[model samples]
Target: MNINFNSEDAGQIVIGAFALSVPIAFSEESWHLAQTLPLGNMALVVLLSLGFIALFAYQSVFQANVMRRIGVFWLRVAIAYLLTLAVVSVVLIALDKWPMLHQPILALKRTLLIAMPASMGAIIVDSFDKE
Candidate 1:
């Protein structure tokens, strides 16, 4: 039920998130979706993304005693999601794709859209060295 956030795991998650998020973040369709999707719809996407991340983590990172490791499991899931968000945000900013500061909601939606796939990759990568 206990898990540690080691540097190697963190590095893997960062690499995985970056590898997946960058291309999606650059997609014009993704950007347009962020701008046009209704707030409720975007919120749903965010929720769905987190749900998938948790499922993936359970299946891969915490296959045994998942319920008993609720706190650690959620912590790992949150870390993966947060890392994906950061990677997506940085990539968007680097590519000049980030929404204006006044449009924080749009930025959040964009990041969430990209974070969906990024978090999947991260969760999978996390499973690579299970012991």
Candidate 2:
């Protein structure tokens, strides 16, 4: 399958990301967990998020033809993850939960925790328009 990622894909990713991010971003439990979870766990979460995205994209979007279109595969994954991260960060910043200046680590943890689900939403949405 040949994947042509364009502005439409980006828009879908952002919408999908925002769709799931809002609820998780507002959750008090997530806020508390972000503060309490150790940095190592946060790192694990990041890895898990990327792993799931790659797996899903390969199976559902790329259809396991990664060798044929390695660049497109990585590009889709990168866009989905990065766009979701941006959406989550914006939501957190708007809610005053992202204290980047005061505690950058905490802010990043919170963003990562939320981005996990948001990125899934993005990948799923991106797959919807595929042939």
Candidate 3:
């Protein structure tokens, strides 16, 4: 189960991540969560998101040979999470939802919070190609 990290794969992850991230980015609740969630809780959200990405990637992309191809497995997981964050940031910025200039950490936290579900969407969409 050596999944190649090709350009097309990258494109699909971006598309999938963006599809889910956009609506959340526009949500008032998401913005408030970013502003009010404690720093420790925000950190937990990031860690949990990465964990979900790793689990989903292992089950869908790497399958049985996950440990054998651990590098590729982690790489896919990282890409999916990073792409989710990137797409979320772009959408937030476009919507004037990102307050990076005024509050950088809040902006980042908001993106990470939204990236959780976006990454799930990305992993699921990427898995669809397997079937």
Give TM per candidate: 0.91, 0.95, 0.94
Model 1 over residues 7-68: C-alpha lDDT tens digits?
Answer: 98889889999889888987999999888989888778879889988887787777756776
Give me the candidate number with maximum lDDT: 2
- Superposition-based RMSD of candidate 3 using all C-alpha atoms, in angstroms: 1.2
Give lDDT per model, in order.
0.84, 0.92, 0.85
- What would the C-alpha RMSD of candidate 1 be, to one decimal place? 1.7
For residues 1-131, could you state the per-residue lDDT of candidate 3 as single tens digits? Answer: 33988877888899889889988887899899888999899889989989988888777777756766788788888888888888999999999988999989988988889998999888888877764
Model 2 spans with C-alpha error above 4 angstroms: none
Return the lDDT, model 3, position 32.
90
Window of ten residues with lowest summed lDDT in model 1? 60-69
lDDT tens readout by residue for model 2, 37-127: 9989999999999999999999988888789788889888998999999999999999999999999989999999999999999888988
Q: lDDT of candidate 1?
A: 0.84
The predictions' CA RMSDs to the true structure, in order, are 1.7, 1.0, 1.2
lDDT comparing candidate 3 with the true structure: 0.85
